[model samples]
Target: MSLSLIFELSIWITSVCGVLVALWLTWRAGKQRDLSALAGFAVMMALWCFGHLALFHGYQSLGMVLLLANPLMPTFFLHFALLFVNEGRACRPWLTAMTRHIPWIYITSIGVTLYSIWVNAGATIRLMDDRPFFVFTESGALNLGYTVLIGVLAHAVLLLGWRHHSGNKRRSILAMFGVGAWGLLLATSFVFPSFGIDVFPYPMLLLPSYLLLLVYGVVRYQILAVNRFANRALLALVMMLLVLCVIAVLGVFSGRVGLEALTNVPIWQLWLYSLVVLLMAALVYPTVRRITERLVFPGAVLNEQVLDTWSRQLNLADSWTQLVSDGEALLRRQLGQTVTIKLPNDTAPSGLHLCIEQGDIGWSAHVEKTDDLSPGMRLNLEVFGSLFASSCAALERSLALAEAERKRLDEQHLVELGSLSASMAHELRNPLNIISMAAYNAPEETRKHIKDQLARADRLVGDMLVYSGKLSLQYQRVPIKSLVSSVLTTLSTEQVSIDIQVEDTLQIDADSHRLQQVFINLIDNGLAYVRNLERGAMCVEAYLDSGRFVCRIHNNGPQLDDVLTQDELFRPFVSKRRGGNGLGLAIVKRIVDAHGGTIVHRSDCGWPVTFEVTLPPDNTEGDV
Candidate 1:
């Protein structure tokens, strides 16, 4: 009602509200570790309000209370600026050091001012009739030094805000206001009248506009209130309180203001007032909450669900196999689609496909690093990534498991090929040895039959050696034109009209013996097919296309049937030639691939079945 009461009430209420807010904020942050700056801001705010209260309560000379507040007040301003700027986390270590020396700094500074007042007669103070107490100090160099020191510290905070200049304009402006406030307060309380003006007063109101600015950043733009649930509850309370006032007023206006029963009752009157208030509040709060939630919490609940689901999924998935199955199911459930995990193959000698899929989602073959894993999760042991992913995640345990299975199957395949080669080599040798012995013992007429058997044995043994992987390579760059000529010469004796259309001087960097063996296999087949006719056509053509040396060997042979489908023709121990071991063409393919190349068998149907061999041209052979 009165000016003094109003002033007293404003100071007490502001002080109490500020402290309570600070306490709640600080306590909320204490439960977590990362929000140190937030907690620091809270504690600083509390100290700041306490300092303000001291000055406001006419307690300045109560053991130097006003001066005691000086150190913390500036510090709270700096810290508040930091937090408001979203740069608080980076500020504290320096301020912690500042706080450590604050006691000494404040005591020394206060001592000088007090000394000047008591002993030097340079400083004084008085209570104003129209104003509160004021510091009456000089416009001396000491006063300038005080303003400069506070300005330097406050400006230091502003300087730090430069990194966030574009990020936090509000903080920057507020810090400037603080610097101005300190400077103005220094001038008015210490320098203004001494220089000739009655007032140039800048006090608590100078910089605090920025607190409202902060509230705006938080409420409208950043909305940091949701970060602390207390703010939300407080908001709910305010809305409810407003609704209560509205309904109480409406009831008082609509009905009798002084009803006997309502006015006479003591407990009931209070209860009626409270009930009316609560009833009105009930009408408005849910609507306010729904509006706020829509604005502030769109997709928030869904985000939480995702986080919870991921945490649970990771917990439930244990082994690589289980991990894969769970991942597949989870992804299917969450994403409503199937997800395939694949890794490149390294040993397969394919480009960018090394480190092949270890397995599906969860497989035991992956010796996963569990140190960084939880009960339901694993870390990719292959910390190194050699291939690109749709996203850059190490193969999950499920995918790793699938890849492991593939590797095991490849190993088993290699083992089976080994055993088949050994059996074929054994079957070919027995009769060949006996025929050679019999031919040595037989007379001339009988010896011819055994010699034929020995020749058959030689072909068998050659195929056996290749299938067994015992064939040695005489590797060197050889001219293909000359090599093909020799193969044609050997097979030309058969009743075949051979046309050689060759790419001359085409050098291949390969095993001459192995290449010769491959050419012989094709030539021999061509001879067999063409020889069946009284006279049949055969041709061998070699040329280069796209860095590959392509050799086409054709004969007037029957078209290859469906039995030799593209996939089946490459299988070892399956031969198309009569009494021929299936190893020859398979061996030819293996040799070509060993030299960093690929070969595919295709039948060119003319009068003849043409076999095509495509070998990757060597870089060295380019010039040769």
Candidate 2:
């Protein structure tokens, strides 16, 4: 082959090689790849194809063909930089905007170049149509400005975004810049009056090398599953296109060439033919992607590679659901073929059993047993019996321990009750003796004077009996309105007002005698606290609320001392009041709570010093 013919062939092959590689990369990127990145690459490849074909079409000097693609060249370079650095979040808006505007940046840069060509300029706009001697000198102020502006801007953007990228990102972006730099150098050789060199477009070849590095990085990271996607598409599409292309080439070249005959054709027609087919494929990509996804993973959101992925994650149970209890797991790992369990003669099945157990406590287990033994069959009788014996023994020991503990607790409770009753009986003796002695010796006139003391003595004894469960509540239908009035009348407070506003017939299932004591304790505290206050104001009100008998006692007194934390106030013998035995409120709380009533204290302004009690409709009869 002659050198020129060889050179032409290589150049044609080089251009063809660029198309093949670009197509493969895009296909590898697949639908899951960012459409913006794919589209950007597609634009670059399409424009580049135009530039190469224009050169081959004997229209190389116009510069318009390559100019059309100049903007995309920088854009494609920036994309590679991003591909290296992107860690899988959607593309940043600002970076995407900058990238999208790059084609305009290139077109704007070429605006001056095109204007120079239009104006029939002197030094920069030279027209020549030949080889080594026909090289033109471009040195007008406009041309220099144009070249410098584009080169500087491209370099500046590279430095800003790509230079500081760390790790493999830095390496990949640097390679992109290296290829871009060479491309610029080639363009510079063509325009500037620097020298005569046929290597003006030589730097363009380095684009593929940089792209190769990028492809390797992609494969290394398994990025986009590009290698697999690209390889499959290349194998399929190339075979289809080549078979059709060659057939068309042969038919065009010779009308009667046999199917077996190898026919050669021009590179130009092959490119256009391949391009027609490629464009048609590109047009159908959306449909192809949808169809392929449905066939592979119907619900897949990101077009994941099915073969590359595992169907079921065996031990992912940890991530899926918590194993809060010890038990069997539906694991993907292999397991024993059959599970055998030994059971005691007396145990019945319960849910959530052991997979296999053998003991005297009786083995409770889950298993796959499919044997029917006739009366004559001896079914490994000794081995099975031994296993059952151990399980049964373990279960029996555990049950015995639990039963012993329960019995001991019951005995201890009975002892505590006896001790309490004895102590209470002894404590009541002295108070009872004092009241009895006073009652026997006092005359009728002095009896009134001793009444208060006698009543207190009786109250103390009643408390002891209540604690011992010997105090019987005389359950009666006590009208709540009448009850409140009785408490208010009996415990008359000169300094506080007792306001009764209950339903006409709010009856309660209560021993009115004991409830009268609960009222006395509450009213006494209200009187003491209110009397000491400068305001000296207190009010007790009763009403129906939320289908219950609600009663509230209010005083404009200072808050209970912080020493009466709510929990402490509920305990017997614990009180915050200056003069209190603390048993009063404790007994009141116990009685009310035991009757399924509710009480709460709200500490706020305007409604300060309040006691709230609510009782459900009772087990007594009343009109309403």
lDDT of 2 at 503: 73
Q: Which regions of candidate 1 are displaced past 4 Å?
A: 1-6, 13-64, 67-72, 75-107, 110-132, 137-148, 160-304, 307-485, 488-624
Error of 1 at 349 (Å): 38
Lowest summed lDDT window (length 10), candidate 1 = 381-390
Q: Write model 1 residue lDDT over 397-480, tens digit each, in one string.
A: 456788899999976776685677577667767867776786786798788877876777677666655655534455588899
| Candidates' C-alpha lDDT | 0.54, 0.52
| Residue 118 in candidate 2, Cα distance off native in Å | 1.7
Q: Please state the error at residue 415 of candidate 2 in Å.
A: 31
| Residue range 442-514, candidate 2, lDDT tens digits | 7876876677666666665555445434234566766767776777777656756555556776666666876
- Top candidate, metric TM-score: 1
Regions more than 4 Å wrong, model 2 = 10-56, 60-72, 75-107, 116-148, 162-168, 178-194, 198-222, 227-312, 318-624
How does model 2 score by TM-score? 0.33
